[model samples]
Target chain A: MTEKIARFFAENRPATPCLVVDLDVVARNYDRLSGALPDAKIYYAVKANPAPEILRLLTGLGSSFDTASVPEIEDCLAAGATPDRISYGNTIKKAADIRRAYELGVRLFAFDSEAELEKIAANAPGSRVFCRILTSGEGADWPLSRKFGCDPEMARDLLLRAAALDVVPYGVSFHVGSQQRDLAQWDAALSTTAAIFRDLEEKGVALRMVNMGGGFPTRYRTDVPGTDEYGFAIDEALRRHFGNRIPETIVEPGRGMVGDAGIIQSEVVLISRKSANDLRRWVYLDIGKFGGLAETMDEAIQYPIETERDGGPAEPVILAGPTCDSADVLYERAEYRLPVDLRIGDRVAIRATGAYTTSYSAVNFNGFAPLQAYYI
Target chain B: MTEKIARFFAENRPATPCLVVDLDVVARNYDRLSGALPDAKIYYAVKANPAPEILRLLTGLGSSFDTASVPEIEDCLAAGATPDRISYGNTIKKAADIRRAYELGVRLFAFDSEAELEKIAANAPGSRVFCRILTSGEGADWPLSRKFGCDPEMARDLLLRAAALDVVPYGVSFHVGSQQRDLAQWDAALSTTAAIFRDLEEKGVALRMVNMGGGFPTRYRTDVPGTDEYGFAIDEALRRHFGNRIPETIVEPGRGMVGDAGIIQSEVVLISRKSANDLRRWVYLDIGKFGGLAETMDEAIQYPIETERDGGPAEPVILAGPTCDSADVLYERAEYRLPVDLRIGDRVAIRATGAYTTSYSAVNFNGFAPLQAYYI
Candidate 1:
């Protein structure tokens, strides 16, 4: 955890199962990402963590926003972001929502299908549009499905169709995956994007932009390459693909922008074994899948856990949330070792949980309140 | 769909992505369950759909409650349920919560371990407690894990130990599974509970109650046995296990109690294919896994879907929610079919969603509001 969060926890002693985000860490991450991609515009994905403080900070830093809905766009505008700096990023949207975004003077939008393109054409007239193409989502901790994007050929056809639909065919976009570890994945996605650009260009429809959707890695239980390495690899890939005629680039980083800036402080409610001879202890915590750690749905995105009783003998335990549902178990198959001296009411800090935790929390499942969040 | 919900939708023309629950259906289901099991107390599981209206109706019907948390207990009390009529049902709970329940005059609790039993004894002295034993969760559409229960031997030891800890050893509880289809599964679980009861009686600690936890099935896309079949099987099991001296029994029904009482009305947001040659259409709806239908996590619960254009030719479609997250896709492998003429803005009614939908909704994942509900 960051020193700011640690000192805040030490002084305030906030209630358990609360998220503490160090704003300084978020600012540092922003600066690091900007320094690495000096030419690309950073559209901070608002769905990750839309704390007003973080939004205001990013707005002050001259960052653009990638919003998933009309309310998110309004959030960005309320945080002092100009309408020109917001991009409506979700592929699936209602026509009413499209009209709302257009009325708000947001000009950039993302779409992957003809129906969505037609809706945008009719609702948000003269807006710039980007077509999202499919990626294999290989080599990432959280791989995306084919829900958001279309085939490269479909993207080309949609972008070409946009030329006649009163909207500008701005660019093409693709997401490798969330928490992408392999730098080569970007090159693979960019190659398909370049081919689409070339295919559209030959038909006299020139695309001027390349939206490299968010897939930047963040530290979890394992090490990942630094921002400099990612920047170097992306620079090399751009050179190989565009050959000095590179398009105006945009990178939307959600998890990489704010994931490591926060920690979840939970307390051990109970710890016991099922049988006398059972070797594994079941450790139940105040927060669970419905509370904020929804990323642990399939035991994916294992957060590094630390206890105050560290440096003592430890054993593998079945970690679970304080809920009645059986699916609330967080890490059963994964080896989660905890200190044997851990007792009820002892605090456990879950690391690198800033991005998806609070946003994914259930409203009042089992009568548990949503995860309490504090921006330091 | 129930005639009441369909009429309400037609008349109100409520906004898309809303839930409409027919209280009459819930009342009828409760009466049927009571008629099937004439002697057992119905402890309505509050985690299913804890609407104040439903709770008040059940309270008027003289139903007890099986609450999962302190807030749920407060909800039950607010709905006019007496403290004696509510049971703390979650096995994993904080000591502070136990004390709070005690202060609120709650005297009955559930536990599966010695640590939890001690917490109950210290926090709520002289209270009655039930031990939960592990069941194999077979023949269940939504099978539970071993997260909440202990072995039968372990349960006997804990209940025996509770006799000396100032807490009464009330009985044993076991869940066959959620949406359980096999009537024989109850017989198997009761066999385990019977052996535990016999062993405890031999050791001079005679248990007085048998808390048969909820596993009653509800109709979804397919037909399930009526409540009478379950009642007959449970009655036979009780007779075979305890002869004529059947203990005071309790049944906790969550999904089965209210699953069929509500329907989620959602609008089709977008429809498209990955490519020109793609055979399956992708259907996007305004409400998704995060919006309320969280039981679709692994496609474990398939809610029956209906549309206005159902009579036409239909083809298999990949269903997804209106979110940027790839995991929001509802059914990709499941053979969900939609009418070929289904258009954007057409209404789709998701059946058997009254229990888990609104309760499992995310606070606001993608800037979308929580699932709105109307109880008539």
Candidate 2:
């Protein structure tokens, strides 16, 4: 367990099943990434954790934002971020929302389809637009499906269309995937990105920026290299692929930037044996899939969990969240081991949960309160 | 589209991606169930759609509640329901929450483990307590996992232990499953329930009630029986199992009680071909899994969808929610056919969504607003 988590519990005595984000850890995580990739501009994806305190801290550190909707843009602005520093990154948005973003002085946007492009042209005229090329979401913890970007050929046509429609064709972006583990995936995505740049150039549209979308990895149940290693590999790939023609680059890091800064303390509600002969114990927690742990779906991103019990023989236990719904199980197939002597009221600390917990939690499933977040 | 949905859009012009609940339909549904199951007590499961308006409507119909938490009990009370009319039905609850419920004058509770039984014994003396026995969760649209109940032997011990601790052992309960389709599953579950009753009688503890947990089905993509069929089958099963020794019976219906009463109207954001050669179209809607359609997970509970366009050739399209996250895809593998002429800004009506939509929505993921609920 991280010292910040232990200290927070020791000092604050906050409610169980609550998320605690240590600002000191967040600042340190930000510093590590910024120091390693000194040249690459960082746009913190506001959707990851849109808590006002997190936005304010990132904004104080001179970080720009990658906003998904108008409310996100408003949130960043409320946290003291200027509209110029925010890019409307979501490809699927309503025309009215686009017009509102433009009215709020936001200029940069991203689109992957003809309808969205037309809407953007009609609503946010003369805005800097980025056309995303689809990337194979291989080897990422949360592999995104074919939902965000278009193929390279379609991307070329869309960028050219953007230029003709009075919107500036500013950049090309592609997310390898969220919580992407394999660095080679970035190499492949960057190659596709380079091909998009070439095809746009052949069409007589010169792009000014290349957005390296938010697929940067976080350390979660896997051997992920530190930020420096990711920085070195990303820097080497850009140098190899783009050579001297590299455009102004931007990197959006959602989980990698904020994940390690937060930890969740959940209370154990019950530990019952399924049957007389059942081997594994069922451990129920006060928090669950609906209570801000939705990322635990399909066991894709297993948050490292630690309980207060120690010096006891351990056994595999199926962990679950406190909900009447049947699908609220969190760790059943995934091999989660806990102390056999662990009893009700014991707290389990889930590490690296800062990015997606509160943002993804259901409003009030089963009449349980939303996951309360605390910042230290 | 249903006449209620069309009338809602025509007269109210409610916001897109919003859930519109017709109180008239809800009243009809309540009347049908209460009229059919005149002998069985109906406790409206508050987690289904905890809107105050719906609560008031149900309360006016003289419906009691099956609440999962303290806030749900409070919601029922605020809607003019008396404290004695609410049952604390969640198997997993905190000790403080149990005490608070007792303080609120809630007498009926459910438990599945020794720890929880002890908690209830300490918190609420002489309260009506029920023990849940595990069920197979087979043949249900939304099958529950092994999270809430204990084995028959364990349950027998728990009820006896409750009697010893001065807590009233009110009865035994078991859920066939949520959205349970096959009536045979109830037969098997009732057989198990009878065995538990026999076991409790052998221990000299006469139970006063039999809580038949909610699994009543709603008509979605698949056909479900009317309330009369379910009522007749349940009555036959109880008569066959317990004969004249049957106790006061309770039925808690969440989805079955309210699913068909509400419809969600969502706007199509974009319809794009994934590739030039790809046959299936990708249709993006303004509301998605995060926006309260979370029941779409794994395509388990399929809500019948209708669009504005007709008289056109139908094509299979992968339906997705409008979010940056790729997991928001609703039905990629499942067959969902839409009119080929469907365009952006076209509205689609998701029928029978009153139960799980608004209560299951994320607060604001990716800056998208929570699914707004409008009462008609």
Candidate 3:
């Protein structure tokens, strides 16, 4: 845990099982990313963490937003972000919502299907539209399946349709999936975008933007490359594929921007053996899958943990949340080792949880308090 | 779908992806359970839904509540339930929360570990404490692992320790698991309770209560025995073991009480083929795993669905939620056959969702609205 985070929690003695975010760290992360990728426009994905404080902080730093819903757009706007800096990033949208977003001055939107395109054409006529292209999403910790994007052929057709319908065929966007690691994934994503760019050119529609959707990896359980390495690789990919013809690039960094800025301080509720013969210790925390730790689902994103007794001998433990649900177990399959001396009231700091923890908490499941986020 | 549920949505024209609960159905279910098991007191699990309206309705019907946390106790009290009518059912609780619940006048509590018992002893002295014993929770749709219960031997020792710590060893409890089927599972659970009862008797602690913990199955995809079957089996088990010396019985029914009382009306956001050549159509709904359908995790509970176009030819489809997460797909493994002609703007009514849907919603995940619940 960062000294600043530990000091905040230790001094305030704020409620246990709460998230503490440092705005100083967030600003530093933002500066680091912008400094590395000077040319790429930053659109912070609001879904990662929709706290108004974070939004206002990012907005003050002149970061644009990639929103998934109208509420997010409203949140950004409430934080003094102009509507022009917001883009509706979710491909699946209710038609009514599309009209609502359009009325709210959201001109840029993303869609991956023909039906969505028609809905956009009907609701937000003359607005800018981008089609998300499908990628295998390999080499990412949280590899996305074929849930959001379409094929290159479909993208070309959709772009043409967007242009013909009087909506500006703004660009093509593709997510390498959240927490993307290997830089080679960018090569495939960029190559696919370049192919669609050539196809769109053949059909007499010039795409003006390339949205390299958020997937930039954050430091978690596994080692990952830094922002500079990612920036270099992305710059190389753009040069190798589009040469000097690279369109206005947009990077939607969700976890990469804010994951390391926050720490969740959870209290140990109890520790016991699962059974008399079972040697493995079961460590139950006040916070579980429902208490703002849903990203621990399938252990796809493992947050580094820190406790006061970290130097003691480590013991493999089955960690669980406080909910009565059986599936609330966090680290059973992907084993977690913690200090054996940890006891009740001992704080365990879940590091780098700033992005998804607060937003994804289940709304008072089992009557547990919604995660209280404290920004320092 | 019930006519009342369908009519409410049709007439109200509420926004897409909302939960509609019929209090009349809830009252009837409550009456049926109470009517069948006259000897057992009903404690409606607030964690199942925790909707104030539902709690008030249950309170109006003279039903006690089984709360899991301090907030739940407050919700129950706000709904006009007396503190004596509430039991803290969660085995894992923070010490501070235990004190808070005690200060709120909640005396009846459940614990499965010594740590929790000690916390209760220290915070809520002389409180009525129940120790939960372990069971495999076999043959249940949502089979619970060894997350909430202690082994019988440990439970016996814990009860003694509770008495030593000046807490009343008021009862013994055991859950067969949520949505538990196989009436034989109850036989095993009850027999284990009988053995523990005998052992406690030998140790000079005559238990005053027997909490044949909730696991009464709710009708979902699979056909389940009615309340009468459960009541009959439990009555027979008590007769065979304790005869005229039976203790006060308590049934903490969460899903069983309210599952059949509600239906969720979600709009079909989009319908598209997974790929150009993929045979299955993916039907995306406005409400998904994050949007109050977390019970569908890993296809553990399959909710029966109805659409307005139900008369059309059926086709196997992959059901998904509208969130950007790939894991938000609801029923990819358990294929759902829906109307072939189902289109966007159409409504899908998910049946028997009252118990788990409303309370388990993600707090504004992906900027989608939390599941709005309407009570009739």
Candidate 4:
């Protein structure tokens, strides 16, 4: 935990199951990403955690925004981001929402299908649009499904078709996947993107941009390569694929920008074993899947946990949220271990939870309030 | 769809991605369940959809509540439910919350472990507590893991311990599972509960209540047995095991009581295929998993969908929510089919969503507001 966060916790003693984000850490993360990829423009993915404070911080850093909905566009604008600095990034958008974004002075948009392209063309006339292409999503912990993108051939056709419409055939885009570990996955995706770009150029479209949608990693249970390594690899891939000319590049870092900047403090509500011979004790926390840690679904994003009894002997424990629903379990097979002396009411710090925690929290699922968040 | 809900939708024409609940349907469902098992008192599981209207209606109908948290208890009280009609049902709870519930005059509680029972004993002194025994969770569409309940041996020990504490050692409780289909599962669970009761009686503590937790099915994509069938089976199981000494029984029905009473009308945002040869069209709805169809995780609860053009030729489609997150896909492997003529801006009604939809909705995951609900 950052010294700022520790000081905040020690002083305020906020309620348990709350997230505390250090704004200084967020600023440092922004600078690190900018320094790592000097040529790429950073568009902070606002859906990660659209706290007004984070948005204002990124906006002050001259970071562009990749928004998922019209409300997000309004949030960015409210945070002092100009409409020109925002990109409507979600491909599945209502026609009315597209029109609203257009009316709000946002021009750049994303599309993965002909239907979406048509919506943008009809509603946000003359807007710059990028066609998202499908990736294998091979090396990411939370691999995205085929729900968002289309195939390369379809992307090429859609971009070519865009030229015939009122909207500009701006570029091609693809997400390797979230928390992407294998840097080579970027190389593979860029290769397909370069092919699409070349094909579009041959058809006289000449796409001018390449949006390598966010797949940047953040520290979790295991160590990950720093932003510098990812930047070097992506720069090398661009050089290898695009040869002499790289298009205007953009990186939308949601998790990487703010994930490690925050911590969630949860109280151990109960700790007990199911039976006399049960080896694993079930440790119930005040926060859970519905509470905020939705990323822990399927034991995917294992957040590093720390308790007051840390540095003492620990044992394997099945962690769960204090909800009556069975699916509210955070981790059962991930073998999360906690200190043996961890008592009920002991505070547990869940690390790297800033990105998806607060925004994904349910609205009082089991009468538990949404995960409270405080920005320092 | 119920005539009431359909008429409301036609007359009101509320905005897209809203849930419309038929209060009459809810009342009828309550009447049906009560008629089916006159011996068992109904405790509406408040977590399913804790709208104040539903709570008030149930309260007026003399329904008790099975609450999961202190806020739920507050909600019940606000809806005119007497404190005596509320039970603190979640096994994992903070000591402070226990004290709050006790202070609020809640006398009944459920626990699965010694730690939880002790908390109840210490905080809610002289309260009635029931120990939840683990069930196989077989023949359930949403089979619960070993997250909420304990083994039969551990439950007996806990109840025995409860008797020694300040809390009353009420009888046993067990959940066959959510959306349970097998009547024999209740029989198996009751056999274990009877053994625990008899063992406790021999130890000079005669348990007085058997809290059979909710497992009652609700109609989803396919038809389920009516409440009469479930009530009859449970009654038979109680008779076979208790042998004329069926204690004060309680049935906590969440989905079974309200699942079929609501319909979610969502707009089709976009419809497209990945490639020219891709057989399955991807149908994007304005409402997604985060928008409140969270039960569709892993395609477990397939809500039957109806569209304006339902009578037209139908084709297999992959349904997804209109979010940038790829996990928002609702039904991919479940072979969901939509009308071929289903167009963008068309309204689609997801049936039997009254129970888990609105309550499970994220506060605003993708800048989309929580599923708007209208109780009529």
lDDT by residue (A194-281, candidate 3, tens digit) is 9889888988999999999888878987789998999999999999999889889999998988899999888899887645666788
User: Where does the lowest 10-residue lDDT sum fall in candidate 1 chain A?
Assistant: A140-149
Please write out the lDDT profile of model 1 over residues A234-271, one tens digit for every residue: 98999899998999999999899999999999999999
Deviation in Å, model 4, residue A249 alpha carbon: 0.4
Off by over 4 Å in 2: A1-5, B1-5
Provide the TM-score of chain B versus the true chain B for each model in turn.
0.99, 0.98, 0.97, 0.99
Report the lDDT tens digits of candidate 3 across residue range B34-84. Answer: 987899999998888888888999999999988888888999999999999
Scoring each candidate complex against the real one, what DockQ results? 0.90, 0.73, 0.62, 0.87
Q: Is candidate 1 or candidate 3 better by DockQ?
A: 1
Candidate 3 chain A — worst ten consecutive residues by lDDT sum? A272-281
User: How do all the candidates rank in terms of TM-score, highest first?
Assistant: 1, 4, 2, 3
Best by lDDT: 1
The deviation in Å at residue B295 for candidate 2 is 0.7
lDDT for each residue of candidate 4 in B1-376, tens digit (9 for 90 to 100): 8788888999999998999999999999999999999999999999999999999999999999999999999999999999999999999989999999999999999999998999999999999999998888999998499998888999988888888899899878889899998889999998988998899899999999988889888888777888888889999999999999989999999999999889999998999999999999999999998989999988999999999898889999999998889888999999988888889899999999999888788988978898899999
Shift in Å, residue A232, candidate 2? 1.3
lDDT of 1 at A197: 87
Q: Provide the lDDT at A355 for model 1.
A: 94
The window of 10 residues in a row where model 2 chain A has the poorest summed lDDT is A269-278
Report model 3's TM-score to 2 decimal places. 0.96
